[model samples]
Target: MYISYKPLWHTLIERNMRKEDLRLAAGLTTNMIANMGKGKHISMETLTKICETLNCDISDVIELERE
Candidate 1:
């Protein structure tokens, strides 16, 4: 299974938040954000930070895909 982050784009749109704003609010570095954009696996702690920052659930950010 692969994880997708397409929902994050939607969430950003719904929240009217920019990627840079999310990075700042989540205390994430550009490289980390870039990695996430590339669908790289991130730590649970980082995921939690993102969820908290965006006031969203994990399902609002990541998705599971069958390969």
Candidate 2:
């Protein structure tokens, strides 16, 4: 299985937040956002930051998916 950021995109939409906004609020680099866009693996620390900034749980940001 692979990790998917699909839930993150939905959460962003529900919050009316742009990727740039999330990057700034979460103190994330542009490259990190880019990697997420590509569904690439990111560190748990990064996920923690995102969850904290968005006031969401990890499952709200990512999910395991079958290949």
Query: CA shift at 28, candidate 1, in angstroms?
Result: 0.5
lDDT of each candidate versus the true structure: 0.92, 0.98
Candidate 1 per-residue C-alpha lDDT over 8-67 given as tens digits, one digit per residue, 9 for 90 to 100 = 989998989999999999999998889988999888898899999988899999999998
Total colliding residue pairs, candidate 2:
0
Off by over 4 Å in 1: none
TM-score of each: 0.93, 0.98
Which candidate leads the pack in lDDT? 2
Query: In candidate 2, which residue ranges exceed 4 Å CA deviation?
Result: none
Error of 2 at 20 (Å): 0.4
Return the number of clashes found in candidate 1. Answer: 0
Q: Could you give candidate 2's per-residue lDDT for residues 1-67 as a string of tens digits?
A: 9999999999999999999999999999999999999999999999999999999999999999999
